[model samples]
Target chain A: MHSEKELIDGCAKGDRAAQRAFYERYCGRMMALCNRYAKSTQEAEDILQEGFIKIFGSIASFRKEAKLTTWMTRIMINTALNMQRQKLYLLPMVDVNDANLYEQEEIGLSDFHFTELIRMVQSLPDGCRIIFNLFAIEGYGHKEIADMLNISEGTSKSQYNRAKSLLQAKLKAEQKYENVRGQKL
Target chain B: MKTSEDRNFEEEWKSALDGAEMAPSDHVWNSIDLKISHAEQGEMKKRVLFYQRVAAASILFALCLGAAGWFWNYEDASVKSLASQTVGENQKESASSIAKVPFSNQNSSNSSAVTITESQNANSIKSAVGNYENGVKTRIENGGKNHALASEASNGSDIAAMIAPADKNVLTLGKEAELESRRTSQSNTGFENGSVTELATNGLSMSAIRLTGKPVEQIESARTFKIAKKEQSPTDDQNRNWWASVNGSGGAYNQSSSSNSVATSLFQQSATSTFYAAPNSKEVGVGTSFSYGMSMGKKVANRWVVMGGVNYLNQSIDYQTNIVLQDASQSKAFLADLASLSSNLASTNPYVLRNTNEFISVPLQAGYLLLNRKAGVQLNAGVAADIFYRNTMTDLSGQFGSFSQAAGDNSVYRNLNWTGLLGTELSYKMNRHYQVSLMPGFRYSFNSVLKSSTGSTINPLVWDVGFRLKYVF
Candidate 1:
């Protein structure tokens, strides 16, 4: 079965060493999860500490019905969600009250690297960046984007288009600048 | 004109972002560390305050419990001073007029829950709490007494034979500890026959009484004192410090189930035989500590902390006005100000006073450190005083808030107050620098606010779950 199950069984025998081993195995991965959902790295770390506490404290409950990582991920998500609510963070909604405002414009790719597109997506302003991420990379509709960002579906569609157009222009400008620099060199 | 192929090439451009190349600033670790430290400190302060209350309860339990047939208190000053000296350690001592048959608190980690109080007119000095505690040494001693009581229940059966060499059944610590004790030393007042409830209410001058029919080989009651080592053997008094505190004491509320009465008695017996076994070997250290930890996770353990260096463990309850206003009017105004949203003016203001509130609190706790480490978590309880720290308010501005005041100075605050710590860290060694931690658990406070300044009041009872960390060096 799962490695955690064996470790847990060992711990049930009052094996302090096993318990310590268990803690070390998950601390890093949990910290990574904390980093994603936290407003600041510290806040995420705080969530990590709290999460591990619950983990070790409640280790007896871990019957190994699911993978250890899965169980830990759930705790991490819950902690992050709680922090988000407590800190009044800007979290994207999953569902939508509005419909998709913009249809995806198919810009066929021949030689474009996926990383360039991702960077372009990342470079957008907060509102636009989120909208593009939800629409382009995540494949969410405008309505879903609006719900998550707490904005109008129209705003989502407009922002997505604006992001795409801005990205296209930036790339073209960068390409021209590079060619000029190459000639001079 | 550009060809269709050229146009296609020009329009489509993409590059995959490598995870490592786009790494954020490395100093992010420091930033994360700062917040984590801040939150951890606040949480630690809260927990220690809670532990202090429980310690108080445990001390009180040691007094109220007559299960061991001990003369609860003696009417003498020197003895009372001894008990009162442990006041800083615990705040929940009561005066019972019961006899001091071999005193057994089911929760005593220390063999004898001996304490010397220094209260102004210390009654229980020689009576009950006397010869036992220091202000800071009071709580842990009592908690240890109670802990010993519980532990005795589990292991007493094993140690009973150790008490008397003739008997194979080493006197189980907590088992059958009913030594005949009486509170009828004075006239014919409180005691109906030989039975009395408390030793001396607040008057700790209760005397010791035991019917030693068990045939002791000696005349004077056997009392054992464990001597310190050649090195600076950190007395409980020397242990209390500002920077670090080790709080293993949880709570002293349940007197009947107190492990001290059993454990302390057994340990006392065992301690008497210390010449055979090393005191250092049986010694489990009590540490006092001060530390700051940042909660390093948002999902499970989100926190931030900052270090405050101070030696005083006094608890005061002060109110803070926290204002939580949901302003739909402001939102509408902003929307109106944005000329673009004028046409779609159907949206109304979402801001209306949702929750205008106030909180009441009494924060209680006592703190001290050993070798610069805060002490708590094992001995299992402590004592503290509490007051109010108000944080909720609805002022003249018609705004809702968790804390805010239009009249006088208003702000939301976490004033250290009184609380009862229930469970403690079951000893977990972390990094070399920080070894102190707790088994996650809950704390209950008689008062609401955990802390307070001068004249402020608020209700504050928070059920917090986080680790208490400390630096050993």
Candidate 2:
């Protein structure tokens, strides 16, 4: 039940108990954050392991200027981004013209499982999914995402728009299918 | 300044995933734990290595100083004993010459009256004295030039002239006959009287020998004695005080176990990574090392030398680590996909890593002569403070070409370390000024050359055989 400051001090000194306590305390949220950026459970686990390793390695540099959770979240996100970059370097980029044309229509937001929503986000293309997560969930602007991903601001915006349109289309289709199933019942 | 529709969509997504949680498999923590534990162990190893180096350096420095001091005191005592022996020998020669003159004068004056008896007596005295003089001359020749004894021998003629009058009664016929019989009997008994007399002279010289009572000529002769001694044994001459040597050595350098294990772990980790297609096969060959240095030594004693100087060594190692690519067809599709994203993925061949390092060291060495002859051997040991000069890595292209560079920055290696050396030199004396030697030795480092954080704690154990050419002054 030590405070965040005490845990950080202990972790810096490489106290095993303190490290385990710290990991258990923040791992759920961090894993969820990693999950948002990864396409599968295994990839998310990989990112999670890499992120915690970094946190423990650099805990001495954590001056507690920001909240511990905020600092850890930033580390997790960076780890996921690096993992994406490595994977992206090996894969071909999809043509921009292949993005599905869709209308910007309002979609039902209720009655969707949280896991289903995560699935929808994960289903987006690799480049579009990262931009979408950084912009929509991580609260980063298009300019920041562009700098982070080494792309133009316009590309970041276009990628975000494509991800949003695709998610909207999928959500709408799922909601209509659920309604049709209810009518048959 | 976000658009309304964009703001709504972001809010919807955020709320939808607000409490979403997925616990990773238990093995994720295990993997993290393993990495952290390895890093901690590495840190501990570094600290231990550093302390070991300090202790080793301190012990080596103290030992060199202690040996030099001990040998210096011993040499001083030997020189004093030898000087005392020379003074005693000089006194004996003086007495013997004085006794001989009277006998000679008596024999010449009374030749007709006691010709038969005196001739017999003369023969006896001359035989005994000649034997003693011949023995003394042989000792002087074999013991090298002794200026004190040579000067005293010359002064014997003067002593004989001074003591001639006081010895008249002792030189009478009856007493002379008795003295001859006694000298003859003693000579017959194997020079026992002569030996006793020599011992008495040694005691007297030790107590009463005074350079102050001597004339200026005698003092000048004593000075010349030292010059003659130096000329006789030029190798042992204290006046020739400087020596220089050039040596070159080659040996095999071995890495420590801890470092090798850590490197293996890292290689395994890389092999398991998704980027690499196959497991790495690492072969570490015997590393070839070469070193040469020029050092100047001072002869501190007859059998001791102390030297301090700089040395430079370049060590290179060739370790082939096969970065086997996956099946060509499977990798082709992957490479084509990778090519569109980054043009740097042009080649996919296994590469070899060649590591080279250079070092400069300042060594303070102490040597003791175990044997001194035409063929001799000596033992030497010292401590060296070594500074790392450079480390270079060359990736020779494999079947395809070189892949992305994976080596860490060379600047991360530790710049300074200390090593302990123990070696023996087998030497052949060519002349008074030049000698050649073969020095075989081993050097052990007490600290790692690379930083611990790099997880590479390479400490080299090197065995060297060197050829040396030396000049002594």
Candidate 3:
């Protein structure tokens, strides 16, 4: 396998094999980042393809000051945000009561499949889904999420809380259904 | 902003999706590869177009240079031939007038009327021209019967008195007339002493023949005599002491020093850093220079001439730097906010910048003629005050286009510079009025063209060969 610097140099020089290798190395992880922000698998794939194209085109300008993964992750996040920016402009975010912020509990997610967890996150409202992913999963502060989406900090906080409560209620219902099935069996 | 309860909930979700990976559809990579291929082709096409434009510009400049030289030579030849033809026609008229004098004495005086306009100091010279005219008219009217009567009117001593005046304002015979008079004196019998002897001797002979008791109709056939007067002086030639010229030159220019100023450091900054980094290496190469202008000069002394003119000068320096080329609009950001820039700000491709500086130069020069002849040589020395106009930074590789900045209060270039000049000119006189010269010159700037605030030094030295076409006014 070629080293990261050699692969980057080759891709910058338009080496097709190096470009393919670069894509293959990072596509899976980038696809997962894209999926968290996208509403569907098809939209997630679209974001991943566009993000990789940007990465390749601007590769000559990359100075390698940041870690390769960190730089690529930033590009993926920017691309996903751009794809969802238009919908975010049209859809108004729901403002729940602040009581939802204090009602959080320690929940066990070890039994949930990663795909099922992604589906639960994606199933939230467009504004709530993006805020919850940015705040809970990506560890971005609510103020930073507000600035990125051009929304207020209060709106970001209320939306994340609503999304968390919705996910907890769904997980509890699923656990109850599984227990019922086990009893019947 | 995260509370303890919220932290645990976020931690559980974050760990659950921490290493999530999914396989995208196969078509995504194929589409990206195709788009990148098309982009590479587009870049190649753009580069080809840039080279084509540069080639076309070079060809046009060559054609213009060739056409200017051809036109100058062609014009000189045509004008010289026309001047020779006019001199020949004037001689023929003087000869025909001499042969016709015996038939009409009154008409002879009219034909030979010399309009003498002397300087204010020599106002009495007009009467001298009148006395010479009356002497010839009296001899033609008397129809000379004896050699003594003919000698009295055509006396060589009297003609000498008219020529050697106190103010020297009398008519001076042209070179052609002096040569013709010598031929007549060698062949004829009498009157061989003064400037006008040739025409007087011919007139007397024609008058004596016509008065030989022949009938009117018989003498009419013998009245084929002609007389011509061609009076010219070298001192009175128009624009003999004042001349005007247009000149053009091409040369190589060299910079004797380099600058490590704040401006250069700003431009040499690395692509990713907020603060500009020092250049890894610096190379300053010699570049081409060109100038063209017109000047007016006057002969101040016997062998000295002085001139002053405005010239447009273009000087260039080839600068190769590793600094990533950026848009000029980001200049304000260079000093204001380094953190505002993203990590992807810099490019790895290095480019050459041709620094082209333009100036309007006013030169005052004095020349001493070393060999003043048909082919003359002169030595000249001068100083020029060059007013800065603009400096253009061109990326020769065409990866980025060129930009220009005029000299202003905040500009790096100074508003004015001084240069010392020395040269020798080898010139050839094309005619009485036109001269063509080749001048090879050396020039050196007296001070740096850049402002002291920039902490840059650029003292350029140039060696140029110029072509000058001068016309006496």
Candidate 4:
């Protein structure tokens, strides 16, 4: 297997074998990252392919200052964001005051599987889901998220808070249902 | 700055999603590959078109310059020829006056009878001789005085002396004489020294010949002298200080392919070589070329004209190839990846590559007049630098066949190359100012279009035929 530098050089030259090796090495992680921004598996795959094409085309300009995976992840996220923006632009903006903030629920993290967590995140509205993912999982500041999404910093903060409250309420409801089912059993 | 509750939620989500993985379908890669290929082809086409436009503009500019130069030259030549003709007529009149004095004196002195009939016969003879000499002198003066003096001095020195005014009276003949002379001398003399002074200054022996015969016989002998003088005049070659012309030409060009085995080996070594293999199998069609220019020439010698000017050349070559992909299965696998990713790869056909390369050249050339007459021929040769403007190639291999690529890197090929030119021009003078010409020419390149060590080469040899309209000044 080639090193990151060699892989980049080969990809720049349009070497199919090197491109395949590079794809295989990073596609799993990159796809998982894509899944966070996408609403469905198909959408995630589209973002992944778009990101890879960008990576291959611009490999010649890639500087080694950042990790290759980091660069690829950034590209995937940006591609997904661009697609989301196109779709989301037509939809009406949700006011922060309109969001229903529920009480926080004390549920154990272990109660939810990784797949269940992904589904819960995906279920959020496009605006809130994007904000939550950027802030919570991607560890970006509200300012950066606002810039990336072309929204105000206050909107990013409010949307992130709304996403958290909604998820907490759902987890609390699921735990309560489980308790009732256990009694019936 | 996150609250304790927010921190806890973030940690929970992070741990839950940790090590998560999902594999997209293989079809995604296939779609990406197709997109890249299409982008490349589009870029190539755009570049080729750009170069083509540049070449065309350059040629057009050159043609305009050529035409403007020719027009200016024609107008200048017309003015000059007219001025020279007027001066020639004036000199003829002065020369005839000198020629008439000797003939009239001989006729009058020879007639012995004072009877009106005899005197009238003598006057009639003098008038006939005067008319004959007027015609001869006009032609001789148009031939220039040096030629006339050189050939006719021995036979007509007395007549020459009679016409040459004494140095003191030559310029001071005053308004009356000048006006009278203009009326009397049909061919005027603008000569600085009168014909009499010209003969005396040259130190030629002036002997009067006595005629004892009929006046009609003397006139006949004079006519023979005029014919002999016309034959002795120098060949008519206008030595204009400056001349200009405009010309346009078109021709066919062929570019020789590169022969570097090393680069060919490298191309074959790579499994996914973007460079084409078996370039020779591809057809390189005949190239189209055009050029236009305006030149200014100086008459350096009796039969030599030296000229230099700017010329614009637009040249283009077309190359087409059908390249078979080495591994069909591998491509299928790539497409499968893209399909799995939910992106479709539309094309699976063999790749067809088409490329067009354009160049604009500016040349400075010098021409030598091999023949000069009402109809003339010239030979010209020069060297120029050519600028490679664009190289565009389209690849149509996928099912949709809409993929294109433009090579934007001029350094990949020889952006600048030297050209050697040789040509011959045949011209016909329509009048004093306007001339029409047909030029056949050839151009040879000193460098290949491809950069050194690329294993691919394109060296073009061009032949051209041109029609030119010229105005001489």
Candidate 5:
């Protein structure tokens, strides 16, 4: 496990070994994580490249208390979400009054992986996907989501509910579509 | 701790992402290594060239200065080698002393039994002279047994034959001392080097390199002494050393000149003659020592010689011409007596002595005796040069036949001559090395005129002084 300091100093010196070592160890996990936050495969790959560049460039600031891989994964996620936000697309933010629209249905074991499930959740409209990822998967409360996204607490909770309701209906609708096609029962 | 919840979700997402795989291509690392090597190579080359240049310059400077000083020592070694060669003859004399020993008559007993060691001791001292006298008195009493070694004292006369220009009395004393020292040392425990080993001899023979340094050291020490006394606070030890050096360099300078005449006005019949008598040939071209020097040989050899000096001299040229006076005079000339001619010049101070000075030299030398017969003398030559600074306007005032001071044409006073010298020297070790000798010599400059138009003459000569230091080498 090479540290961020050694990797950074080595990279500045154009050390190929240090660069290759860092890439081989963490690239795979960061790319998958990028896919969840990005709108398309191209967008996800772009985020992975850009985040790694930023990581190497600003590596001097790293205090090294956290694992290097964990630090890298967060950078990748931030890069993808920020790129999507900069596109200025309207987010499907939910109202706090729309809480009843969410359904707490139990999930069944399926051939699809949790990685696939996370990707599906990220495919929601922009605002809903961010709220859904932060509140449900990332476990931030409404107040933290509000502070992080620069929105009101009411708006954050409302957006989180709308995201949950949208994922539930999409899952139900995808199930029905499969049932009608009869490719699987 | 609140971030713990976010971290948990991050971990879950990470686990979900674990199945994905993507690796960086190898090109990035290859690019970095290539860039670094190029930068390092450039820096290393620059550093190496810088160090190489510094090393080369430092080596060159050291070699140049070292070679110049080394050349001076080469000259000294030649003189020493010649002096050492004189010892070979003493060994032959030693053998002859042994041959004279052994005849049976009671009167001849001591002379015939004269051992080599006793003869070596008796060779130079009063005891040796006395013993030889005793042998002769014995031979006269008994007649004929002590005749062999008498021929070898005749050999002392042989060495004396080669030493001309040397004072005979000093030469005799030096020879006797050398023979005595050899005889005494041989009579005592057979000490090394074959000469009577005096304790002082150990300190006397330093080396040539040390002798050459005396001039520079004398200057430095004199300067240091002056500075030591002037300084506000100094150790008593430092002042003591300076005084010791000054005292050790003790010598005196003296000058004398004479002129005789009577029945004079402003001048009379001058004792000094005016005719020029320049040497037809140069004896030797002098060196540019203009400084003192000292040398030291090994303990077995003689040490300590201080010689070499510089002197500055100046003079103006003046002369009379019959052709010029005959051409200018219109009336019948008056007859002049020898005293009147010298005393009342047709013209005096005709040309302004604008400037005149050159080297007037005085050199002091001292040395140690290496062997009783062979001792070294340091020859110090003093430096001098001529300079003419004033002009010839005084001669512009012409002579009054009425013998009155008045102004006239001074343009005839052309070509002022001035002179100077090269203070060069060489050392010699005569048979009796410590016997003091003085062979003062002159170096004359051929330059007769100061400037072509100045009409002044200068006499340039470099003189050397000689002195003896008894070897304690």
Candidate 6:
């Protein structure tokens, strides 16, 4: 039942018991964030492992004015991006025109379970998946996402729109199947 | 510029996934823990190595100091024994010369021999006196007449000729001779056989052996006998006070590990993949340090000395870079021109880069002797102005060869650097003219070796063990 301050102080001094406690307190929430950006569960675990290592290494530099969770979350996002940067160069990201931003459609994600939502997000293309997680879930603007990924702002918006359309189509087909199954039953 | 529908869509997605909790596999924590342990081990090794270098230097200094003390004491004992042996031999020679001199003028031939002996004795004594005054070798001939009979006989065979010139007369009883022995021997005292007699005449003393029945060859050998002469001590001269020393040292040079931004940035961007671990400050290590110099020191006071000299100092460092050849594409900053010239950069080879910095350092130091004796200990503190000469970067693996940059030739290092020095010298006076010393010292640079604009701070510290040989004039 140590306080957050005591836990942070202990972790900064490289106390293993405090680090394990710190991990247990924040890993589950951080794992969900990692899953949103990573394409697979294994990749998400890889990102979480690297992120925690970085957090422990640099915990002494953490400013007390910010929440520990927010600091740890930032490290997780950066770790995920670092892993993605290697692949982005091999599989080049496409640049879209500004007119492609108009093709976005509104969709309801309430009908799906959290696991099903993660699956649909993971099924998107690498560029779309990263851009959508940065824009839609991480609350970053298109311009910020473009700078982070080294792409054009229009490309970030176009990738987000494409992710939304694909999820919309998947949700619509699932709803149609459910209605047909109800009639058959 | 966001629409209300777009805002709602993003908010819904954030709320849905942000609170979603999922546990990672247990192996992830284990991997993180392993990496941290390895990094800690490397840090511990670096700390241990630093202390080990200091300890080694200290042990060598202690051993050298102990040996110098022992040898100095041995030389003192040997000199004392040699002086006693020379005294015993001189006593026997004096007694024999008195017994062999011809004392009788009973025949015309004996009278002529007496005249010849007196003339030769006068010439030998005059020559010996002249040489002694000139601070040169004093060799008395003609059977040790004046010195052996007057000086050795009266002083009980301990004193050689303690002669002081009396006007034109060079042969007389010196201050060391006893009045009673001079008066008794002056009365022409005869031996038990009445063939040997002591005679004093015309400011000359003679012990004549009247071998009237003996062969001429035996008399000739006795007449040619030459006594060993002791020279004046060098300590009596005030001019032989200055000393010169030549010294050599071997040790390690350490840099302050806190600021290594230049090396860090170079290593971090070497590999494109995050799987390979990046090199840290601990990997930048001391390689070798060596210096040799000569200085002239004089005892300014009873226990203090001052010296200044020039030294050629060389320090080296080993940086274990992370730039493997297979990952050379991303690390264009290192050897970029060579990389562009070659098409094949796919080898997964690694090499260590050794950076050597050479300097001409001038040290002005003052020393204080804590124990000033044959075996002595001195504490020295000083400062040096080190001028940069050149730096050579060589691939230790022999693959990349080497390159060098001299001062003001597009070098990143500063031209002038200041260093503080402290040392303790354990010295032994081997003899009147020679001494040997063991000096253990530490040096620390006050400013960075590199330029301020380079954003790299490198203050080097050196621990060395020096051996110095000194000669007193």
Query: iRMS values in order, in angstroms?
Result: 14.4, 9.7, 6.4, 3.5, 24.0, 9.1
Candidate 1 global TM-score? 0.28
Docking class of 3: acceptable
lDDT of each: 0.35, 0.58, 0.61, 0.55, 0.36, 0.61
Q: DockQ of each model against the real complex? A: 0.06, 0.24, 0.33, 0.33, 0.11, 0.27
* Candidate with the greatest TM-score versus the true structure: 4
Identify the runs in model 5 with alpha carbons over 4 angstroms from their true place.
A1-9, A88-100, A177-185, B1-473
Residue-wise lDDT of candidate 2 within A130-171, one digit each (tens)? Answer: 988999998999889888988888778777878888998899
lDDT of 5 at B193: 21
Residue A159: error of model 6 in Å? 2.3
Which tens-of-lDDT digit does each residue in A1-185 have in candidate 4?
A: 68988888888887756777788888888888888888988998888888988898888888889788778878888899998998778873455864448356657769777767787788888888888888988889999988887788888888888888888877878788888999999
Q: What is the C-alpha RMSD of each candidate to the true structure, in Å?
A: 26.9, 23.3, 22.7, 18.4, 35.5, 24.5
Candidate 1, residues B163-276, lDDT tens digits: the string is 222322211112112223222343333122221111222223222212221212222222222111113323223222222433322211110111122223323454322211
Query: Model 6, range A1-185, lDDT digits (tens) per residue?
Result: 78888888988998866877888888899998898889999999999999998998899899999988888888999999999998888997876544544454556777778888888788888888888898888789998998999988887887887777676677777777877998999
Query: What tens-digit string does per-residue lDDT give for candidate 4 at B128-198?
Result: 22332111122111211221121112233342332232211111010110000111121234222212111
- lDDT string, candidate 6, B51-140, tens digits: 446545654565576566555444333322322332333333333233223422233222112111212123323322232221222222
Model 2 stretches with alpha carbons more than 4 Å out: A92-102, B55-59, B66-473
Say which docking band candidate 4 falls in.
Answer: acceptable
Candidate 5, A27-110: lDDT as tens digits: 676766666666666666667767766665555566568776767766776777678666524543445575467444533325
Predict model 3's lDDT versus the native. Answer: 0.61
The stretch of ten residues in a row with the least summed lDDT in candidate 5 chain B is B221-230
How far off is residue B378 in model 4, in Å? 14
lDDT of 5 by residue, B410-466 (tens): 221113333222221222333222223333333454464222332233233333332
How much is the lDDT of residue B132 in candidate 6?
25
| Structural similarity to truth (TM-score) of each candidate | 0.28, 0.43, 0.43, 0.47, 0.29, 0.42
